[model samples]
Target chain A: MTPGPTPGPLPGPTPGLRIRGLVKSFGGRRVLDEVDLVVERGEVVSLLGPNGAGKTTLVSVVAGLLRPDAGSVSVLGTDVVRAPRAARGRIGLAAQDVAVYPTHTVEENLRFFGALAGLRRGELRTSVDTLLETLDLTPLRRRRARELSGGQQRRLHVGCALVHRPRLILLDEPTAGADPQTRRGLLRQVRALADDGGTVLYTTHYLQEVEELDARVVVLGDGRVREDAGVDQLIARYTRSELVLRFSGEAPELPWPGARVAGDTVFLPTDRPGVDLVKAVELTGQDRERLRAVELSRAGLEAAYLELLGAGRDE
Target chain B: MNRALTVARHDLVWLRRDPAPVITMLLTPALLMFFIKPLYVGALDRLGYRGVNGAELAVPGMTVMFSFFMAGLVTESVFREHGLNTWARLRVSPLRDTELMTGKVAPCLVLVMAQSCVLFLLGRVVMDLRVRGSLLALLAVMAALSACVVAFSFLLCAVARTRRQAFAYERVTTLVWVILGGTLVPTELMADWVGSLAGFTPVYWASHGYREVILDGEGVAGVLPHVGVLCGFTVLFVALAVWRFNGGADKQHWD
Candidate 1:
């Protein structure tokens, strides 16, 4: 958890990543509008957003690949725009695209990026060896990147970014098109990195990963921060569990209030599934013989994300 | 500078894995030099040099002309990073744009210089070519020409929007310079008006320096002006490249 040499005065113990009044536009279309966010040290923040929701734009701006029209981004107390080199030294960005040199072997790719990050002889070697083992790339270390399969290449791509053991890691959909094993390995590494006091900002369409990482989910939509909370908290606050009753034949009219029917199944949105299940059964006393199954559908991260995004569209 | 060298070392490693392009570039000129020696000898004879064999002009001429294709190798290396989607990764690293460009341009510089030295070695060993001037002066000309080619490649990378466009530009520009600058035919042997345009090409000065040392037996002092002109061209190309190169621009990597 040693901080790299930051070449400026610090404003106390700063967060790993901080953005305020951030704005970015492309061809007059605002992609990010007055956004504000902060990720503390040792925190793993999962950024959730739909396509075209400016998730990649935000990552690009933080990586110093694109200039932001407004606002400020500070990485580990260094302003990204003002001192890009200093900020960049502390950030490791694995872009959404699978980027690696096809001509270079897995080990070469790791070493090259490590050297660029100013890692020297023995330290660079140790980092590369550890990353190869962590990413399950040791056996394939000598294999050129082009020879690896899609999933193997994806793993190597992510491996190249963090080989320098950067302070702040930005993973933009690191698991896209990855196999189940690759995805799991990456998620585990991300969690481990965070647990070791390294900050991580991860973006993914897969909500399960967020829950798996126990990350604080930040749902972004319409160029603004919509929701920021823990996964269970979001589910609890934004969604309701449903008491579902499926009948064998045509669903009879339920006398219970707030009951909705679709295709012989009745749905009752409820905070208390046990009491509602009993009430639903009692209400369908005569039709109870035809009831095929009773189930409670608990809301999860996906439902909460949908509710948040849907609410965004409503406004 | 060390970071740039690291990148350069990375590029050199990749070159070792696939040495076909470098191998072809180095060997292509030797074959051309061997086949065109008689023509060069006749041309040199017509220019009032008695008993002069063709390697004097053919070796350096082909070396300078083919070095443009060597520059193409650098252009390809730059765009290959983009094509492989590695450019963004490099851009995201801590290296500055100049360092990244240096890393890419350094290996190609070595290759271009190697091509020239190898060609001259073959000329000496096989074509009965002798350098009456200082070898140090000849080496300086080669080094300056290599720098100019590398700079010109960066300018091509800066302006071309697509990989195909870069290749097309490289071929057309190289051939145009070859014809106008006296690589294919000495500017003296070309149409009389072509002389006015010959001095504008970096290759023209490169070839002129070679002639001074190899043909006229000029020492280091004799070829200094041509080397200076080549260096000037290098500076101008570098300035234009820096002005036009946009690291953020979305170049069409494949098309």
Candidate 2:
């Protein structure tokens, strides 16, 4: 295998995964069109998209299961297509669906998958033990995988992928069927993994999963990467903070600079809702006194993502 | 090699945990052999075949036939991963197609051999199956037969997309194999073309090997040719499986 460039003193880590001009088609229909994405070391890039947005397809290509019509996927500086075998050890993928042996115990499933990653005997045992505890599967380790609850199975599925501890991990909506608590557990672990220098490419429906992880957002729509930016940048460019001011009787729209009245409330779009709350009082003279209650709504990833997907559908 | 073994161990661990399929594959054939052994010996006696023992003549044939039919367990082992959704887990891993199939193949191979030996042992203790021939020769033939059946199982799995499809193919082919191989009737009674076609299948070699050792007392030297033929069929079947698997014709559970 060709060695990557020698590292110099650097502030940010190099790109662990880089895909360029990725195009894939099935039955004459293009599923991924010139998709480009980069996730640096210690970076968690959420591959956010709705159903049929080609999230799984892109993941399949990167994981070396699906060959792309045109493009290259380099994982940990090794091209997955050209050197899939070399790239395999450096990459771990937790696909959207749960894929564990139902007949085996949770620990056995963990051990089997971990061993496949080429871990040694002692290393394999240690990895499985830590993963079982981390994934909250320690108590249920001896239970048959099929006997676990839905949430528990989902967690076990994630554990199977992470048991190998690959440097570059692709989580294709791992939390899809997980309950809220299970989802939080998975997100927290993913975040901790990233903090420990693992690059994560997580795709999800729940925007909060990405939000809580504080991951960079790579919004996909129409088989293309529509937006790639940090959480703050994505929210700034695609969402607006809405400040709702309910009136005692009638909403007066003559005070706040950006306040728009709808029925009995005035809405203001601002970056800071807390500071803008005082602005509403100072800017509106009699309307502020007439204000019954104030509600500040922050611009969030959920709104930005929906708007992006909605616009893609419109186009 | 270790990777393939790990995948095999994964299957083995699960199989041992449940064990119902393996147990059924073993017992079903043993029971069938006992019922059919008497009828075979009675018919052969009435036909004036002097030295032929009914249990020896009919028991091994029934044993191999049931072994081939129960080879559908191979389909169950491979495709059940699809049903349970664990196949995709292996697919996306570093495990190669050959390695995955090799791992899946070993457990079935071991099970099929054990099933065959158990039936032969039970036949010997109860039904007057003599040691007129070399015991090692009989075991060698059984091992070869097991390989052929196991190889066929893997190939059928590679060709078919679903568990139903694999079993359907297994049913169709096993009937043809049983007929051509002379499991139900003697190949000596078969027409020229039917016997010729049977010669092309692994079943014919297994039955031919058993008769040479058990009835003819041919020993190692006598059954060598049959073992060679069965081994050839084993290679052919396994190669066919590898070809389809490598060609990417088999539908993956991940897709």
Candidate 3:
């Protein structure tokens, strides 16, 4: 595979959001516990976890909508708990639900939220127009928010959050319940945001999004960070290797160490390739001419996520 | 501050879209004043009470009752947004608590004013309730009543957990105020002790103040004590509402 370009440095620390030792609970149930994360300007960090993994709680606390029992959250150098208004102004939150006003048209909703974010008349107009075009929502600009489809409403929610150009963005399942096409479109825009020097903290159950963005993945289980590492490293460490061997004759009964059979192919897991290849040919009683094909591959992120989550644990 | 207004503007849009509720709120007072008033007057006549016509007495009472309904509508709308988690979205924004409080107060005040105007016009044009006072006195009474309604609504919004609860509380409280304060039926029709006790209710003061201005041609001085009492209620309700608002703690859950 060709090597990708190295990423540029993060934006200045002035607008970065940092959290440390965050903890929270509700009705005697611990939701988030001692969580820590940092989203530097211009970087995208995907918080990957299953449902009920406390991802939302963490984001809420960082957004200053919730106060943690014990922790410190600082946004653009201001403590969220101490200076919530200033900290909140620097962050944009696209809620999990489609939280747009149903009574207003798309443009009106955007204009209202934009104005709330401190944009004036001329700037608000330009910003709303630009967001509409970028999200391909201009066609539905005059439509009341309640009249839009679920995906359209979700897109409008994002547009509302982006209207004022907040430095840090917290997206909670931004593409949840969306069709494949709509999900792709939203992901494209989110990636573009990161490319344009914006910091994004994305939480979702879809592992593919983590892979698509090549973002650092933080896996949470039972309100704790299970792993935090690069996607490639994660796949290498958590996934099992698989090998496919095609033979001309019936499948061999030979002890082909650590191998499984599928149709006429023998799937093997072997680190010693040359030794395994020789053994496979001899065990199959095939000459060099009878060898059909051989392939080696590692598992994807989905497999890694399953493995990390201890799939089929009862077994 | 601008952000709060933005929220309020969006709220206004939502309110306009919900035409059914507005229609019901607008019609409630008219029905009470026009249809039920004659029945009340006939009952008083049969009882041999030498007093003013029941319909005329009910006109001012219905006006204050309309103010109560207006308060409940606005408060319920805001509380519904909170229960649906939309308030969480707003709370996380740059909007401060004061801005949000102001935004909430503005629309309810506007709605109360509108309701008062509609009732006043109906009383004047349709019912021919004689206007003895200057228009300025009537205006002052309306303003005071509107302030009380807005403040009471804010108090309800701060405490209500669900939309259903808010609506129930609003309805029950308004009904109790009307029945006890002689808004629905004249206090003179009740026992003498009950009539005296009704004077302490906020609704009683509001209706009494309006009667002084519209029926007696009294200036501000004539209704100063009632105005003062209503103002006290407003201050107390507003302070409690602000104190009870969640300190940005409702948005912590991911699920």
- Choose the strongest candidate by TM-score: 1
Task: At residue B239, give the lDDT of candidate 3.
Answer: 92
Please provide TM-scores, in order, for all candidate models, with all chains considered together.
0.95, 0.92, 0.90
Instruction: List fnat, each candidate.
Output: 0.87, 0.63, 0.69
Q: Write the per-residue lDDT of candidate 1 for residues A237-303, one digit (tens) a residue.
A: 8888888899998888887667789989998889888888888899888899999999999999899
Off by over 4 Å in 2: A1-14, A253-259, A271-289, A313-315, B46-48, B191-193, B246-255
In order, what lDDT does every prediction score?
Answer: 0.89, 0.80, 0.78
Q: Which interface RMSD does candidate 1 score?
A: 1.0
In the predicted model 3, the residue pairs found to clash are: A116-B3
Could you give candidate 3's per-residue lDDT for residues A172-264 as a string of tens digits? 999999878778877877777777777788998888888887777888777878888888888877775766677677545456666787666
- TM-score of chain A, every prediction, order shown: 0.92, 0.91, 0.86
CAPRI category for model 1: high
Comparing chain B with the reference, what is the TM-score for each candidate? 0.98, 0.90, 0.88
DockQ of each: 0.82, 0.63, 0.65
Q: Which of 2 and 3 is the better model by DockQ?
A: 3
How many Å off is the CA of B111 in candidate 1? 1.5
Q: Give the local distance difference test score of model 3.
A: 0.78
Query: After aligning candidate 2 to the native by TM-score, how far in Å is the CA of B57 from where it should be?
Result: 2.3
Ten residues in sequence with the least summed lDDT for candidate 3 chain B: B246-255
